[model samples]
Target: MSGILAGKRILVTGVITDASIGFHVAKFAQEEGAEVILTGFGRLSLVERIAKRLPKPAPVIELDVQNQEQLDGLEGKIREYLGDDASLDGVVHSIAFGPQGAFNFLEASWEDVSTAVHVSAYSLKSLTTACLPLMEERGGSVVGLTFDAQFAWPKYDWMGVAKAALESTSRYLARDLGAKNIRCNLIAAGPVKSMAARSIPGFEELADVWKHRAPIGWELSDAEPAARGVVGLLSDWFPKTTGEIVHVDGGVHMMGA
Candidate 1:
């Protein structure tokens, strides 16, 4: 059968490795017929190596979300990559980083905590807004990856605060962009054993909690479903949905743990 996202042009970030959730999103988006673009931090060669694995190879663009100059150049960069006439159909804000300090709350420094907020939270606003010019031409969806914003988790610490801020930021973006028929939403995903998750001090402990607490049961290292949720939201199906937080945590957020 055919797919839902044919011919759509989408940009996805935060793919550090094949284990990263962003990788699955890019893989599936291409399978569903979308033209995928990728943004990478640190090393371009690493991203270039991984790019060969996607359904259709994508160009690796350098875009450290925290870099103002890089952010400012995004629209032009994208246009240059996709040609001037091809406007963006969707954007994935699957970007975040916090260092070790952000995971220990009481032990975390202001510098580290602030870094968490800037990279994990504020960068979403930066990225989405940078892509706004392309999206505005015909309306589009902005999907961000998030964790539960309702409560703090043990060892999740400052990253939790950043997530809360991210959720609020997404809603604000949705509100501002609604007039243009653009949508902004988040996928509050379960813990997956990605490179980013490995940075957390007690990720295994948190994963154990999910394995037990989630009614449907959650996996420590599964990202496929989360990727599917992102692709679906990016598609044309959820036209009226904006400022929404869709929990893809295997029903864990619903029950008391």
Candidate 2:
């Protein structure tokens, strides 16, 4: 192992299956020499089972970002898992979800829209703050995933908006945490066929576009490429970079017509 992340302790969220981008990140992080912990979103048992499949067994803890109590007690829980002296070297926020109503543009109510933003966007701040105590002293990196929200992707209405907000939130976090030496960035990935993607109604809008436009082309079934980008950002290679969106969309973002 090159051990690019040797001696680093990282937190990875949103792993429901081996196909999840978080799964890939955790897998690669381990292969590259990092001790990782995972957050279970309302299903610790399922996540625990999945964690066993990783290169090394990682501890999975319950964490629903919307729950204030869980967020508040995260540090102590993590410390208990990683040890008192364990200071996180990086965090991967692959968490994002939108209620069904929010998938429709005009049909989405403020209630639905807010839920999307809160889960997909606001959680970035919430999750990061939960780890701030462990991160602030030694400083680390925070990396999240996003489906490019620049345009109105069909059936991806409110969720798209939430991602844009997520992008902005990373920038603000980078600005504020820079002095503390904490870097914040995001990976704007192409359409991936993860468990989350299967839940979305019209995810094909992206797959269709990628097939017709992407210069380098994209493989919806393959998340390792995008996953690699996130792990790289979590490593020491991107020490001086923050607030940037690393696009892993196979040149699709660069094409207009």
Question: Which structure among the candidates has the greatest TM-score?
Answer: 2
Global lDDT of each candidate: 0.90, 0.92
Model 1 spans with C-alpha error above 4 angstroms: none
lDDT of 1 at 95: 83
Candidate 1 residue lDDT tens string, 1-257: 26899889999998889988999999999999899999999978998899989878998889988789999998888889899876999999898888887788788899999999999999988998899888887999999999997897888889999999999999999999999889999999999999888888888877887867888877767899899999999999999999999999989888863
Clashing pairs counted in every model: 0, 0
Candidate 1 at 120: error in angstroms?
0.6
lDDT of 2 at 34: 94
TM-score computed on alpha carbons, candidate 1: 0.97
Best by lDDT: 2
After aligning candidate 2 to the native by TM-score, how far in Å is the CA of 63 from where it should be? 0.3
User: How do the residues 40-159 of candidate 2 rate in per-residue lDDT, one tens digit apiece?
Assistant: 987679899999999999999899999999999999999999889879999999999898999888889999899889999999999998999999888999999999978888778889
